[model samples]
Target: MKKYIPLLFGDTRSIVGVGLRACPKRATTIGSCPYVRMRSLKYSIWVLIMGLMTFFTTPASAALDIEITRGVVRSIPIAIVPFDVNNPNNPNDIARIISNDLNHSGQFQVMPQSRLPQQPHDADAVSADLWKTLGLDDLVIGSATLTDNGQTKADMTLLDLFHSNQSTPTVLMRQSYTVANSQTRALAHHISDIIYEKLTGEKGVFSTRLAYVTVEPLPNNPRHKRYSLMISDVDGHNAKPLLTSTQPIMSPDWSPDGRSVAYVSFETKLPQIFTSDVATGQRRLISSFAGINGAPSFSPDSRSLAVALSMGRTNPNIYIIDLGSGRLTQLTDDAAINTEPSWAPDGQSLLFTSDRGGAPQIYSIDLAGRQVHRVTYLGAYNASAMYLPGSSTKISLLHRDDRGFNIAIYDLQSGTMQTLTQGGYIESPSPAPNGRMIVYSTNVGGRRMLGMVSSNGQVNIRLPEVSGDAQAPAWSPY
Candidate 1:
């Protein structure tokens, strides 16, 4: 029997210690050199230690590299003092939610609560000198009180600490709101929106919602799976399922007003387009043509939907369906496969995928004259094109090259394409309502998950890891 020694460094494990030593007779020259044998054993032990370090430290090193590469380099420094709560066990933390929202935007760097010198809940209590000394340019202070009507009343003050001559912190904005306990999160998001807009010249999308599809394996059967359509806050909190089925649901598009979502559901063994109200879960079949009916996108005015339908033909073509009168108008009448139609900001034309150019490429079509023109010529493969918010000349789409499929933004004026992602099968690029970020789905270790990248290709973030696979994210309007 042999005894082994085990060495542990934190959570890592490695074997150490020398094996049993034996010495042979001095028949051969220097056969009984135990010192030399011990030296070899010591060198072998050192090699083992180095190997253990490589195994345990590589992952952490890689994580740090990722953080540095994806982090915002020039973020504004700010702080959010924890709100004074009337009840210690109150369910909502308004200040914390606001802090997370700002931090996640990649435009602001929020100081940790532990490093805050004082917790101020009012404008008069904020110490401009203390905050300026800490190198903070701005601070947010708020207080939450429980009302007699079982609601919470919150008052927030945004202070700008740049003016040193001012005896008190300069007030940038002040807002007060009263809402039920369940609505506290929404109120916090509204506050974040106000602060963000005041700092940045652009409107904030913190109060917007996200719609996505999640897939998970069945409980008792690993071979079977279940799909769910879910809606959540912009920060991935308070997710509520709208529909779940064994069949697949895909291509969710939010309406202009953010009251309804249109998607494709395969419930009857055939793909059909359906529209559902987000609040009441009431659904209506929008398109169930004889052949392929998919990719339903709402117009800017929300009066009609741009969809792809085969109409018993061999190839799918872009069609516009009037929601009010149930009238169908074909937009593209070509032998090429045209689908994934996205409306322009003006709603006069659309950008859609067409294989008429020998490979999948984006083509722009004018609804009035029915004129078609190639929009993407830089790539051999480009699809799923959508206009970035507030920009009619820039569009985001999936591009394919030697690097595989990636998200790329194309400038129509410059005729140049800039790749956003490094290419890991990234798909479904949906720009946020504020046009600051684009959310897509990518393959992570063979599992599909949601990810977001800034419009300028500065910040990248992966949504929080959860039990199921999340995909097909749609950003709601303001």
Candidate 2:
């Protein structure tokens, strides 16, 4: 038996070790490689297979710094007043959190605290004429009080300032919440969601969660890195590690119910699929196949997983494993590489990547009749495809063009593709539940960080890490 050391770098693979190269523009195959028996792997796997040599144990934090690079030309102007708090020592800023959440969505232009004309905790105290002079359309006023029962009570009122022929602002919505003091941030996010929905007519993702992989070098050992699977709020707060290891973790997919996450881990020096409970740290082994086990995606019902497995073969295939019975059903069996399975909204079919057509492209496979059909033809390379929320006629995928690898939206109805990102280093594009925005990993200044782009290409935001590199962001379903 020959041992292989994993190297992280370019597309070149040698006999000494297996290299987790960056996303290549063209298809590649490993010919007669002893370490990795698979014939070919997609660029999604390339973005996934990082340094797998050694593991070091250390704590890693992924506090994200958000920077908006691009925004819409005409965003809704809104004001969020500083909430009046009874306890001055309380650290949570409910108003600030709501302001940041609305601003980051790219649909609203939030007024700065210093620019606000006045601070009012009640809608009746607000001057509609003064806000109309400031050219604001909406106003949010709230108060958070620490009650005597060791709980926090929050009140929020959304006021519409631009009502037709109305001198006084109309109250659109009013809500109250009572939660533990520690959950004040969550309450704030809920309030933001309510305000957004009342104004935009679409559901807001402020209360959703994000799951990603964060890697950092160990304190004592710079040569080894610590990889951790983390879960955080949509705004990148309350980040807590679900699992941390010296090995690499990749391709995290949240369950539709948001109870568990399925991912590939190399803790045992080989790839294996596991699902960890989001609330608790309990993990259950899903796949331990001999040759390869990667790219685990949850079914719509969350009772099954569509995973890529080699099964001691030279080429990988798609398989469906029942979570209850552990029964494995082969979906595709061929010499061509099939991986990166994404379940359809109805769960009757799946979209996967395969090179059977000479280049990597998105293909659909029906589970009932085992029928396969090619979906994309405009691009020479298209992989990592998933259907956008609420729309089956379109998909979001990583497309390679003359400009390099970027995020693109493909329309199945018109057979056209629209590239979203200009930077060629983008990968692992994950769409939010509402299909208004997407979050993915990109290389910025030679460091991997998370970024977001609105569905219409009007906004771009970078979630730069404070310390480590973040990748493979999975947006949780609300």
Candidate 3:
């Protein structure tokens, strides 16, 4: 009998089994799973218009393996009832957004209140029976009260719907804060953390942000092109355009503190690297290197950046740029095309795509310049690579396997590649803040749009209203 162990990696699936166990009987079934899941995400790519592409999420690699081995699906289903708000104050309610975020991870299937069959609006009316009947494993309930001073306080408690009694078991998690607090958005994320840990034994990424690029075509004027740098809530609702220009913008990366973004902007008539404050919109040029100054990535500390610059004029090499002292540290000296540099969670190494292997594949280079290892070898073209933060045991990338370009991941220890996405030209695959899922861009019926796939690459869902060719999505750190 053939033996096989499927490894979960960046894209949906990249089977690296050496004649492994006949590809497991259930692998194919899991790859085409029909389970419902959700997550917010984006995809990045070189500025190109003529050849419209769609993202093809893979079969396995990142999806849950259920029929056979309990390969462990990472997400948990959650249900958040609309808070019993006596007075509606905030424009965006906390409970509703929190539910959206959890479902957006692609890990948890957020059950709509209407689907729960019967759910009491108040704590007094809530019972475990009603929740269990709806197939909801977890629940979050909250309410807000306003004081005479105009400040409203929100009190929320999470219920272990699986274990709670009719009396409403002890609060699994609770927090009180003023309504409309700038940090209120994070409350849902915190709740995500509690439910995530309780279910999948992992942290939550509800507080993450989705960064994507929009190319608004000028229908009337053929020469006018509106390329925009936009960020949206993971659910694709709060879309706000940040920077706009007639030229193209490549590689938008988030800072560790979530205050700034570094990207390659051609608004100056030439390609250059610039850092901008997300809130204040303050912009600064970091590298105007004569050759190519593009693909800037902020380190975990937010003090330095890893950018692809042709300073040495050798090749598009990687360099560490210090924001404070303007110090430049070269990371790779190879003559191969080394672009798309991504910093590891610990900041010890960086992942980038290089054609040194005849085809563009993913490679990791240590900061000390001692070790250089290839991360992707199965595909002829594996340009973009992203590091999933939930655990260091796995790494993700976008690889092509019959389908255009999709997401794949590599098991560092086992050296196995598995496909994560199914179909379409997916790019800029970024892990959710929790590491359970990835968000990328794929053309929906020929129009590029944002989509999400589970970390194991099983569940796939596209964002609503994000259409007409979108690209280069980055997930913010929670």
Question: Backbone collision count in every prediction?
Answer: 0, 0, 49
Q: After superposition, how far is residue 66 of candidate 2 from its true place, in Å?
A: 2.1
lDDT of 2 by residue, 366-432 (tens): 9999999999987799999999997988899999999899999999999989998888999999999
When summed lDDT is taken over every stretch of 10 residues in candidate 3, the lowest stretch is 42-51
Q: What's the C-alpha lDDT at position 445 in model 1?
A: 73
> Candidate 3: misplaced stretches above 4 Å?
1-78, 84-93, 133-136, 145-152, 164-170, 181-201, 219-222, 312-314
Best of the two (2, 3) by TM-score = 2
Candidate 1 structure quality by residue, lDDT tens digits, 1-478: 1111111231121123222222222232233435434344443444344334433444432221112125332445678887746543233588878877886786765665656788878788777888776656678888888789999888998887754457598777888888997898899999998888877657889999999999999898868778888898987788888888788999999999999999998888788999999999999999999888989999999999999999999899999999999999998888989999999999999999999989999999999899999998887899999999999899999999889998889999999998888845889999999888888888877888777888877556676655678899999999
TM-score for candidate 2? 0.85
Q: Model 2 off-target regions past 4 Å?
A: 1-65, 86-91, 164-166
Q: Residue 40 error for model 1, in Å?
A: 56
Candidate number that wins on TM-score, 1 or 2: 2
Query: Each candidate's lDDT (Cα)?
Result: 0.79, 0.80, 0.67
- Using all chains and alpha carbons, the TM-scores for the candidates as numbered come to 0.83, 0.85, 0.77
Using lDDT as the measure, name the better of candidate 1 and candidate 3. Answer: 1
RMSD of each predicted structure: 17.0, 15.7, 11.2
